[model samples]
Target: MLAASLAAGGFTADPAQLESPLGYFALYGDCTRLGNVLAALEQLWALRRHDINVKKHPAWYFTQRTADAALRLAERERLDPAEVRSIRVTMEPGGWIR
Candidate 1:
């Protein structure tokens, strides 16, 4: 709960289907800097992942990255430098943080 600030991804889906082979991906955290975001995207590219697609809208771009079975996780943004950290969690259908 110590995150600098919190924001939800616009991408929505059934929690049950989130773990599918091609799932929608949404990037969270301090996105004030485009370079850091691009670098993070580059890292995934280096992972031999071919589903990386940069869309017109960033939300759609990341969420659309997941196909059917995609990895779902949470991202934390630091107060300084706007660095982001990814956190893994199990989410239930219709479950969310308010």
Candidate 2:
């Protein structure tokens, strides 16, 4: 499901983290992990020239920036909306460069 959703373009990963009663510590911890993953993905792809569209994916304070970046990348790649099945994110929210 995750693969399918990623393949599709412009799907929202709304409500990134903090939407649930998961507590502050856990939320921030999860945000860190999400940031790490996003950084690694960006590095892997040389998104130096890609054009990305951002639509304001929702996020708690912890994951806002990273979520925004992810959305941007997803737009830049022009992911196949039909193929997208899932996204890794918190219930609360939503980037890119190249």
Task: Return the top candidate by TM-score.
Answer: 2
Candidate 2: minimum summed lDDT over ten consecutive residues — where? 89-98
What are the lDDT figures for the candidates, one per model?
0.41, 0.55
Candidate 1 stretches greater than 4 Å from native: 1-27, 45-98
lDDT of 1 by residue, 31-80 (tens): 33556546766774543464444554333323343421232222232233
Off by over 4 Å in 2: 1-57, 89-98
Error of 1 at 53 (Å): 9.5
Estimate, for each residue in 2-78, the C-alpha lDDT of model 2 and write its tens digit.
65577596665546443344744255444345565456447644343333333454433455666677768779998
RMSD of every prediction: 19.0, 17.1
Whole-model lDDT for model 2 versus the true structure? 0.55
Error of 1 at 32 (Å): 1.4
